[model samples]
Target: MDIDAWWGIIGQARAAVGDRADDRDSPDDPLPGALVDVLAVLEPADIIDFYVKHIEVTDAAERYPLMWASFLIEGSVSGDGFMDFRDGLALLGRETFSRAVADPDSLADLPVVVRMSRDEGGWIGFEALSLPITDAYRRVRGETDTLRAAVEAAIDGMTRPERPGGGTWDPEDDDAMRLHLPRLAALFLD
Candidate 1:
């Protein structure tokens, strides 16, 4: 979506939600209103695209997930080891991850850095008992999956609903019925 339009929608939703303009330091900070508004307008696929494009994901599959997971779970880390990495990200549990993924209403509660690390093949990897992705790592990874699922769910929710009597709304359905009716009447008929 266009940034200006996204900002306008974000501003309106933020206003509706009683969000204070002065509270945030930057757009990245938890502008709860903007987060909800933007997610509401943008598709899940788009969110994933944004994440994948903006993050400089490395081809080093072995190190990348650990790095991403460490930053997300522990905030920061100095040295490198699978054990140290696992220990750092041990706090994030599965349900916490699930809410991050499933609930658009709970977007503000999400961690500051929410990105994903994937292998070249695109298969999501998180085994609970393996040599790596140990209990802690797996939990955080599951949480990442939760975020992905939530974004997808939001995208799915944005589609126009089925009509009352029988049929579903199609791509050609006019915004006059789907959105702009009241605004049109207020400008012209009022």
Candidate 2:
């Protein structure tokens, strides 16, 4: 992955989101609006390619604990739910979000993301976020199995009991997810 290129895209998206000159009425939710604006200017496919390449190059498992944590905190506080938050990240386009993941510390100034570092649920949120990515990665790679079935298979094979309740994080779960991310990257990215 071209790290510099990824940073450039992120810088552009942030600037666009922050721009006050565009007289357009800002949505009550700025993040989503910013994301839509960014998407309008960039190719989604290229962003996804950058994301897949990022996962391939970065030791995501070891590197992203904080990013996932922040997502959890942001989700809980915003009441956006993890899935919706992930979708928003998707809308921001992969490159932007990938930069967030690679350098979560940069997000610490954001009130919602700051809570993630302090809250217990951050890790859990991180784990929850991984599931859909894994499924999408598998599908993007043309895996014939259903996403549910694949998720079930992965969960079933786990040595520890699943994290109780819907939105909790488990270290073992994170480990399992880390192992799969590269495969996920390999599937759709050339």
Candidate 3:
């Protein structure tokens, strides 16, 4: 699937589940469930395309400023938590995700982040809206036939840089965080 096709599934899921980016109470809740319903009807190949495009989209989003913004909003977090952070952004759908990719600090304007700043946001990460697609395909294609090789090959063929192409910086540098994400830092750190 292309970007629009990839986002189509994500958009449908979000609309089904209702802005679930911060709903820590139920991590997957109805979103992943909705995805399961959507992906179930797709031809197996389409599922593969959806997942590959998901990686591509999320990879493009992994820039320094975005990462910094994640740290600011979530704080002292990493591993699966960080993955969920990006998923949280992705879960918001294309317009919000694109805005965030273009301007990480722009997140402060979002009500979800605003709630999060005050410890009211539910949680982060929607697993990049991937699980249901994979599960759907695997069920059709069979277990141990995750199509992992095909997905990895497509990703490998892409010109992925070691880091997302924005310039790098220490995420711990308070000055850098404040400088690059003044609005976000203000909300999260204050």
Candidate 4:
């Protein structure tokens, strides 16, 4: 699968979904807007292939730390939690959902991911969240090969040095994570 083509498809989907977001007074479930957009443009098989290739290239635990952090925050807010949010994506089938996340840009369309990325201290939790998300994705895909395990182990090995101290954010120290809660909640509440 050509990743560039997949990227283009994802871009088109985001624009299409953004257009829909503009038309509505408020969308009930904006999280999957990008996924819906992608499905409209690409075949499910192609999407899966794109996703597997994407994951093969990107180091979810290292390269895109902020995106991973944003995903966890989004999950927490949505009541899906990290694993459930991943499972929900997996519902798109192993490949579509996995590939969707492999592209960091696709995550921007997710309300919580966007909000968290903009948060002042969101990086505080990036180290804490990245590995688990990557692990979950691999687990969901049933990736148990030696190479997969080795890669995950390498990522895990880096965790300690990468985040020396406790990497969690103190709510009082930085409430940026929750600053947009009201706006996000209002989107669903109405």
How do the residues 42-159 of candidate 3 rate in per-residue lDDT, one tens digit apiece?
8877888877877777777878778778778777556555566777677777998899989988998887778878987555555545566677776677752556777888887887
Which stretch of 10 consecutive residues in model 2 shows the poorest summed lDDT?
A: 181-190
Task: Candidate 1: list runs displaced more than 4 Å.
Answer: 25-30, 49-190
After superposition, the stretches of candidate 4 with alpha carbons farther than 4 Å from their true spots are 19-27, 30-44, 54-190
* lDDT string, candidate 2, 55-143, tens digits: 33232322334324433344332223443443344334445456555544334443333333454222112223233334334435444
**Residue 120 displacement (Å), model 3:** 1.9
- TM for every model, in the order presented, reads 0.22, 0.33, 0.86, 0.32
List the lowest-lDDT window of 10 residues for candidate 3: 19-28
**Model 2 TM-score, 2 decimals:** 0.33
Q: Per-prediction RMSD in angstroms?
A: 21.3, 13.9, 2.3, 11.4
lDDT computed for candidate 4 = 0.38
Cα TM-score of candidate 4: 0.32
- Candidates in order have lDDT scores of 0.31, 0.38, 0.74, 0.38
- lDDT of model 4 at residue 143? 49
Full ranking by lDDT: 3, 2, 4, 1
Candidate number with the higher lDDT (2 or 3): 3
> Which regions of candidate 3 deviate over 4 angstroms?
19-28, 77-81, 127-129, 142-146
